[model samples]
Target: MKMKISCKPIAAAAALLLGGCMVGPDYHRPQVNVPATYSELPGWTQAQPADADAPKGAWWTGFNDPLLNELEPQVAVSNQTVAQDYANYQEALAEVKVARSALFPTIGVTGSGTRQRASAGSTSSSFTRSVGSGAQIVNSGSLEGNVSWDLDLWGSVRRTIEENSATAQASEATLANATLSEQIALATAVIDLRTSDANIDLLQATVKAYEHFLEVVSNQDKYGTVAPSDVVTARTQLENARASLIALGIARAQNAHAIAVLVGKNPEELNIPHSAAMPTLPTVPVGVPSTILQRRPDIATAERQMAAENATIGIAVAAYYPTVSLSALDGFTQSPLGGLLHVANYVWSLGGSATETIFDGGERSGEVAAAKANYQAAVANYRGTVLTAFEDVENDLSGLRILAEQADALDTAVRDATHGTEIAFNEYQAGTVDYTTVATAQATQLADQQTALSVQQSRLLDAASLIGDLGGGWSDSQLHDPRNPDKPPAQPAAASAASAPAAQTSSATGQGAQPAVQ
Candidate 1:
């Protein structure tokens, strides 16, 4: 004959798995008022089909600098700040695992031995229930395995996992943000260093020309064809040119130091070679403004934080409901040592328990309120970040637009000034123009060239900054979504790209990581 199985435990398990309802408001993406089109968008920046999608790694390659292509990858691997952020992301991932563990039962094994001489009339209720007091000396031993589980009848465990999973993803985004920032910073520093080299070359050329002019004036003085004071003025201009060349050393050194620290190297250990070639600025694709919500890592981080805090609301709400637990013990016990081995000595217990907080005056309510407030703060921060992203794009676009115009105008001015310098020098030799007038013209020519160099540097730096503000090629799906409590979300296309340097793809298709979600 077959024995009937108990239905009580089976029913309890089924109810725990099926009957619990999730409490609290499901997260909603805050209604941010994104602009239809960036008001400050410059006409020069049009959507290029080539840049329509941003690729993941090696954005610096767009500049086509072999050195930048080599150094940009180092930022992800060696930068100290990126290291810290990466460690934090690992910690957050561990926390997600910890929270997820709560959804399952815990099992423990226990063994105990006791030897005692009890008084004939002992009156301890707990000890009396488990042991007898008939004899003066007695020994007892037992071995047991216990299993306990808190039924998630109010979605508490699921909610905790939801919160922590999102937090882990937010931490991942933060790591990506750090990596992107330092890489771009290094790129800009490299640009500045190169520009300094070019300016130094320009100054050396100016000094040589000034020395020749001084020689011409000194010969005129010796021949008594010009005032002796003309020699003094010419000598002074040559000296000033040399001094300006020397002053540039300070800026070049500082920029070198910044690059060293950024790449996790000592200043003395790394020395960039001097070069006069200016880096070409790439046309970074300005996708539609709405893409800001999905492209940037910091924004993704902020948005994930909002979802994490939103899940806490339900966790706090779970506290208001009674907690249900199931516990079971299976063991062997006997009063005497030899009897403990007998099959009949086996004992077992199966039970359920419930706990409810009868009075805490408004603690649960206060906790719920605090969770809501924190979520609101995250929402505000997220919206603010979105607005700032738009501002960054607009600023970059305007920089490119206005700077393009300014550069064109400076080019014309430099050409005109060069012609003026030639004319002024010819007139000076002919005695038709004052030496001082020629000196002033030479100064204007040098100033215009230096200004043009600086403007080019500014444009390069601003172009990189605009790319950083555009989110350094990160996606929101890279982080876990809390709303899918029971489902496995598909991994993001570039999920592995963040941690794998070898996975770096060419910027051929905007970089190679993948186009971010629209």
Candidate 2:
């Protein structure tokens, strides 16, 4: 008796094979120690849950400088460093799509035609032998379509997609970080430029005062009331003040060039006018130290790196399982190139294959071990990044606090010095003190004023630094993940601005001349 094989059991087996089990552990975020409050300040509040999803503002706007407000926005558009990072981010998103494509079957179509001359002796069929001793011309053609699928039975492809997705998110964070840095740099350069202007103004006033003193001594010498040495001393002091005033121009020019470059312009293309105006030092609120995890882009980059490395462990673990491939071909072929698509000439096939490595000299085990080690290193790096972020905020806070006290003390000294300079000049005019005493008092007053100006500059610079260290309004929740479209979006609509569509279009093939800033 002939036995029949049931198609039902074979189909069921195929279905079970296609739906294979995953072998690796799922990912979970690693825990790290977080401080409840910032040590530098008191009454620190934790970041509210709602704040995580809140839209970030342009932090530079708080400085209240109209020129700065105008220049800061250009950094996102024209700065080459930020543009390069944005391009890298677009490339990362494309990688995620590449990894994702592996989850689906690859379908292709092919067509071919060939003409050949066959000798009679080479013929294996009677029909060809009947053609004669001469070579016979033969034509063949095929129209075929194929489907291939590397089944993700162990979820290796999915894990790879996960890794790429995390990496893409990390790239987004890196772009944000770069943008914030450039903005802060621009602000710093502006501060230095304004400080230079203030110094020039102070030196100009000192030169005028010195010139007046030289005139007074010269008049007294003509009247035979002051010694000739007094006139020489006054002239020397005036010349030195003029020399210092000329030197101040060098720093002012250099700072102006730096500001121009930060805004993505040539030095000659921009000319900031000297203004008595300066950026106001902004008051930044210090939240709990743990907020750094959600606030800082560098911290987010580290965290995402950890997640990517964790996904890599799953991919490496999957290497131990067998790889299964399913293939199908449907085609039409004819030897004479006639009626190729006819029912009689049509052909089809379905096949499945599985490959397993029984021995690899422990290569697979080594790969798995390496992947785990990388993940551990990433975890360590993440924790280290968190600690460094806290350190940065603390340092800024302490510097600002201490610098404020110093500024107040310098103000008092400046006031007292100005009064002493007037008294010394009055004593010199009354012939009670020598020109040396008046010169000494004037130098002290100038020094005190310059020191006070420097303190103000430091305070402004520290304020910008503190804002940048706090992520300049960026939050970890703003990461735009191309792989997880259904997840709640962390990127605000305003944050997307001009970058959203550009990023979307670049993912199709990852080719773009310039990537937009977020």
Candidate 3:
């Protein structure tokens, strides 16, 4: 003979799985009102299109500074902020795994062995009568296994996993943002240090020139060709130049401290040589503005956060439906230890249960409202980030253009000062002008040279700032780039090369077409 089993449970599970649909509005990228072209302004040149296929990783390498290219990776590997974000990303991934596991059944095993004496009038005494004993001692042992599952009839488990997976992606973006930030900081700090050093050199040369002038005045005073008061005035000018040199050292030290922090080292452990390592500004290609949405890690992070929030709305809505659970157990039991193992001693049970929240003083409604509010907040934040990113790129563009013009003007000033000094020296040698006139002209010449150096440094810094604001040419490849989270690692050579702007053009601008985030 054959026994028949019902297929009702299997059919029901299949129906639930097939019928379930996630509830919530699917994510839609917000439509932003962007300009066709950046507004024309004084001293501003239009940005040119960059090559789409060119590598945009390790943008700092475009400066062609071997030391900076070497140090950039170290900042990404060991920077404390990047490490924290990397750990958070791992934790989010683990949460996704945990959430995904909820779609399956849970199984547990239990076993017990016991010996007991029964009283004469106890319920077990009736069964003992068949064994011919007034009072009986029983030995019992049993092993049981149970299975429980909550069928995702409404896709609750699937929705939960969806929410967590989006969170994990957001965490990954955050890590990339942190890495990009560290790289930018290190590059900018290095630029600042170099600029400071150049300024110091300029001031040192000025101080030496002033010292020589002071000596000339003192010698002339002894010969009565110059007054004693003139000698004092010259000494005072020399002291002022020395003071300026001392002040420049203070800024340089501070910049060095900042660089140490960027590289994840103690200030005392860092020692940059006094070489003229000023970075050369690269001709950056302006990709489309729409690429900023995909290229900037922070913007990507904001977009992912919106996706997670959207999923949360579904999770909250799921709470309004009834929860169904199925449980089953199978085992054996008997009065004697040996009998418990017999085939006839088998016992089994299966059941289903459900629970619904009929009333909770409006608590469920309130919870749903809160979830909706959270979703709205996330949307607003994402939009705000998009706007801010646009502003930063535009501001940097204007700064670079205006500074270039200023640098040109300063170069002219240096040329004129050099010519004036030559003319003054010739007149003084012919006794047509006094030594005081030549001294004044020489001082003017020194000031103009110093100003020119300062302007050039500013221009370099402005260029670095522009690159940093544009995300340092960080590419999507480095989004998953495996740098040691615990310590800074060197950027790859391929990334460095790819980061260079494709073509040198004065009329280039970031591209205007937007890319999809998902």
- Among these predictions, the greatest TM-score belongs to 2
Cα-based TM-score, every candidate: 0.85, 0.87, 0.82
Cα TM-score of candidate 1: 0.85
Judged by whole-model lDDT over C-alpha atoms, candidate 1 comes out at 0.77
> Please, what are the lDDT tens digits per residue for candidate 1 over residues 433-501?
888899989999999999999888888888788778876666566555443446665655443333211
Better of 1 and 2 by lDDT: 2
Provide the clash count, candidate 1.
4
* Per-model tally of clashing residue pairs: 4, 0, 22
CA lDDT of every candidate? 0.77, 0.79, 0.69
- lDDT tens digits by residue: candidate 3, 258-352: 87888888999988877566677765655456656666778878877887888788788888889999888777766656656667877778989
- How would you encode candidate 2's per-residue C-alpha lDDT over 362-431 as one tens digit per residue? 9989999999999999999998998888888878777776676687699999999999999999999999
- Tell how far residue 329 is off in model 1, in angstroms: 0.8
The better candidate by lDDT, 2 or 3, is 2
- So what's the TM-score on candidate 2? 0.87
Give the winner by lDDT: 2
Measured with C-alpha atoms, the lDDT of residue 452 in candidate 2 is 91
